[model samples]
Target: MSDTYAGAPAKPGTVSARISPVGGLDVLSRNEVARLRGASGSGLHALLRRCALAVLTSGNISDDPRAILEQYPDFDIQVLQQDRGMKIELSNAPAQAFVDGQIIRGINELLVAVVRDIVYVSTQLEQVGFDLDASAALTQSVFEILRNARILKPQVDPNLVVCWGGHSISRQEYDYTKLVGYQLGLRGLDICTGCGPGAMKGPMKGATISHAKQRRRHNRYIGITEPGIIAAESPNPIVNHLVIMPDIEKRLEAFVRLGHGIIVFPGGVGTAEEILYLLGILLHPDNAGTPFPLIFTGPRQSAAYFEQIDRFLRLSLGDEVARHYQIIVDDPETVARTMIKGLEKVRHNRLDTKDAFFFNWALQIPLEFQLPFRPTHEAMRALQIHHERPRHELAADLRRAFSGIVAGNVKEEGVQAIEQHGPFVIDGDADIMRALDKLLQAFVEQHRMKLPGGTAYEPCYRVLNA
Candidate 1:
């Protein structure tokens, strides 16, 4: 509830403050406090520091994961247990996170979220020995994490729309996303996204105005992110509810299970990864009857972008995969109307199946999709991206390929590996590799690989015919 400025000489653009816990998290056990205080290489302190810095610098636009760390190297955070509750002590934190002399309220809640997730995952989940290796167990673990975050709303109907897009996009495309979001909000739908800048922030920005116009209250702008990509794409200021999953796999699962429908905008490898992940699961025979609304849309100027995505997808996953989603161009009203109709189908289907409205318990996600993929050089080369396999299986491996490229482009570990071992080599069927190479080239030429102000992007993975 209170914070003090550590009135001492500090790095420019950085300040020191000890702030009280916000609403998200307020108390921790003695052991939890000790573990958070631990600064060893294996302890939670380093992870806490990185995630905390990301939260403190919300709305930062940087594709380089290391940029924030390098900017404020001395920044640190600790969880201090006290008589009444717990307090968060921040050292050399970003000055922008504070206004006048107090920490920004929203940023404080997000910081508390960072602490809450790190502690829960380290102490509650891992220590309890959840068999994360098993598929069912893994899904259960994801549910537990969301439940612990209090993100699962049982009374609410199926209204959350997951918006997937890139942080680096043109002003035209960004404006288009906001337009779609505005239309969606006017229809009484909620917005969820990866929680970064650019397209992720656009829809939420648009929705706020429409919501206010309609006199709506308690609107949810949920942002779901993982540890590896948080620093690269910090949560935008519009994200009122932020949940950090343990890894990318869990993060993807949380999106599909929580949202009633999805809207994908123009993006690069990361967005492509999301598209393929959903397509792969939907293609599963067990989920063939499930009604999940998916739409791909953008401004008219970006038509070619979606065309390229469509071509690549049809080539890789076959023409039938196109049935799962529709592409709407330059029409936000139609996009919103289509999504509303789709949600009704989702609603009826859920009712008939006797499933929970908040979570999609009936969707069948296989073990392959649940497992976390560490995109190393050897693993990248081992992907089977040929058309000889089942459509869903092929989509799974293709998703992994895009995921690896995303890692090498932004994630710290993946970047380090690429620097030390060189760009990853992806070997697959000749035609598939050719299509992938062309798609990736388009992303680079369009500057979709990174934020606009950064240096030109270098390919982090090379595709070759096997």
Candidate 2:
């Protein structure tokens, strides 16, 4: 509990405890039980270990998620289904998560989240009936995952705000996000984010104070993440409702569909990728008339940051794309007011359109956006970033370019590829590639690419002029 600026690194701990799986997760199929039991290659144990460790080390500082694994290479998680409930046994878990003997309650809940989502996705939802390849069906699958996690609320009146931003952001930018979150919470809105540090965690932290002051009960600090990038950016301790989506695409889709409104804070490649994903869908001819409220906000110090982002969007997707979002800086109250007003419109629009308030059933997310992009060397080179295609289609490619950059920066497979092969080669229209290169460089120069004080940000992909 000492808020010392620096302290000796806490040595790791080992614990044995029995925790009942929350929300009937204990009733998992025997096959699901066996998969969690696997600690080796054939079973889903490796995925379970990485995710469990990430939760146990919630406030992790290093962006190279592999760092912890390498440090505690023998760390293992086991699921024991007894006659009573479920017990999660952890060996070589991080010591920071425990005070005396028992694990922190919040960390325990998050650990359960790791097992819950991993089991659900691996066992039930990925079956042939899920039809993951079908665009509309895939969107439904996102709803199913969220619903199964009990995230989609039936009686809510549009108060969930999904906050998007980079894990590595400036101190000033991070503070600005708190102000925005405070304002939103004061107005009775819940906050959701990618569940990492920096911009993603700041709002939730800010909102907690406001919600406490307002005596708001049942305030949800929802954190939605996928395992691939999660180790690099562990969940911020504030996240109470954590759901791990199967992959990045489904993760993004879950955010858009589950929340009533979205606010983009100043960020790096990951943030840019999210912006492009929404822009692409918003610009789609079928979705042009939807009433989703989107805003880009930051503190006054972040004006230059926004300017850089705005320039990139206009340059890459054309000036008309500006119509999809508004940039409000330095004012949390206005950001809150704007979101409230916008969500009112969202509610009315949903009622009039007969769309479910829990999920945006009407949003037309095409197959290209739904399917996961591997960001392999060949795939990065194959992206179609140009001016001639429809703006939405162009946004998808731009999204892929950013996605590849994000992968190269943090995801496990992406990092290993960069180590084995050199940086990924991204070929695109001359002007677009130049702009992309410049923006990525700024991220590194500002130390927005990786957690501060870690190794210098390494370029993960090379941009080629078309």
Candidate 3:
């Protein structure tokens, strides 16, 4: 997409404004406001600045997080509490977030979401003393974050479809995502995604139109992201609800817990990481009968992409892994139908197990998958990707491997790490190593590893032979 904002040039510069909150983030305690105003040394200011810049530049596509920061170095935001309610003041903000000196309504709401999540995490979650070490406690943290965002609805049935894919995707593949999303929306399903551009934005864009056609009021376009990623992949403009989790692990857990099903589009290592994360959980023997629908899809021209993904899964995790998902090429209607059918099974399964329809409480996600994986060079090299380990364990390590690649690709800290220490070395089982090398090579060749129009991607990792 073009870096330029759509419509009239957006006044060509920054503007200062104080605006009242809309919707969920209208009220906050005095302590919360003070916490949000903490300086850079205290950690809240820097976090707030980066996330706020991302929101102001929504829809402008550039994978490099620092690029946006450099462009608008003077931009800043502050939460101002007044007698009326919560008010936000922006200084030297991006003009794109405003039209004719007034902030766009959608962007304002998302900006509020950024503040709400940051303050909630800093104050509520940390102060509550929730035991983060235990798996159940960690799961509860995810629930609490979602609940604080008003994401969990008690009366709603199983209808949320969590779409996972790369923020950088081909136009054809992006259109395919929209078609699938349109089909799902027509069927009354809601959309949730990583809240970025490209494939993440495509589905929500399509679903909005379908929802309008069906006269579906209060249709949801939920976007979930984390601090490490929000700068690079800002919440797309279509998102009606936004939530920021503490880390990628919690973010992934939130998606699985809140959604009824998952649909994956052609993407790079980030998408692969998500697929493995879900598969790892589903492969656990305890989750055998869980009816979570997963589909890998793209345009007909992208058939080879899904084929490569399928072969990799089979070769690494065995053919039994194939039972957990379907590869649907170029058939949006069938993908939607399949998801609809699978959701029926999911609804029945929830009823049978006496689990809540909104959250997948019964899904036994091992603590290993729930824990955060910091992809340092040493940590990346230490992963045991051999076949001797259980399939789920191997999948978790493989997911980490991909997660490292994703980090190096877009996240600011990961990029700095790579620049300082050179590429991360990943050595594992011979066969798995070879498969990984081939897969990454394919991603580079297909321009899936980075945004197509940006700088050429340098290898962030080296897969060593066993």
lDDT of 3 by residue, 316-365 (tens): 99999999999999999999999999999999999999999878889998
Error of 1 at 209 (Å): 0.4
TM-score of each predicted structure versus truth: 0.98, 0.95, 0.96
Error of 2 at 41 (Å): 6.4
TM-score of 2: 0.95
Clashes of each: 0, 0, 0
Candidate 3 lDDT for residue 343: 94
Off by over 4 Å in 3: 1-12, 39-41
Give the per-residue lDDT digits (tens) of candidate 2, residues 1-466. Answer: 1111122333445443444444345466667778777732345888888998888889887888689898777666778776766677666567687777667878878888888889888777865477777998888778878887878888789899999998888888889899899999999999999999999899999999999999999989999999898899899999988999989999999988888889999788899899999999999999977888999998888888889889988998889989989989888899999999999999999999988888988888989999989999889888888789888999999899889989988888998888998998987789988988888888888888887884667799888873
In model 1, the runs with Cα more than 4 Å from the true position are 5-9, 39-41
The C-alpha local distance difference test score for the whole of candidate 2 amounts to 0.85
Q: What is the lDDT of candidate 3?
A: 0.89
Residue 278 Cα positional deviation in candidate 1, in Å, after optimal superposition = 0.2
Better of 2 and 3 by lDDT: 3
lDDT of each residue in 1-466, candidate 1, tens digit only:
5477555555778878888877668478888888888843447898899999999999898879999999998887878888877888888899999998689999988888898899999989999998888988999999988998988999777899999999989999999999999999999999999999999999999999999999999999999999999999999999988999999999999999999999999999999999999999999999987999999999999999999999999988889999999999999999999999999999999889999998888899988898999999999999998889998899899999999999999999999999999999998889999999999999999999988875678889998962
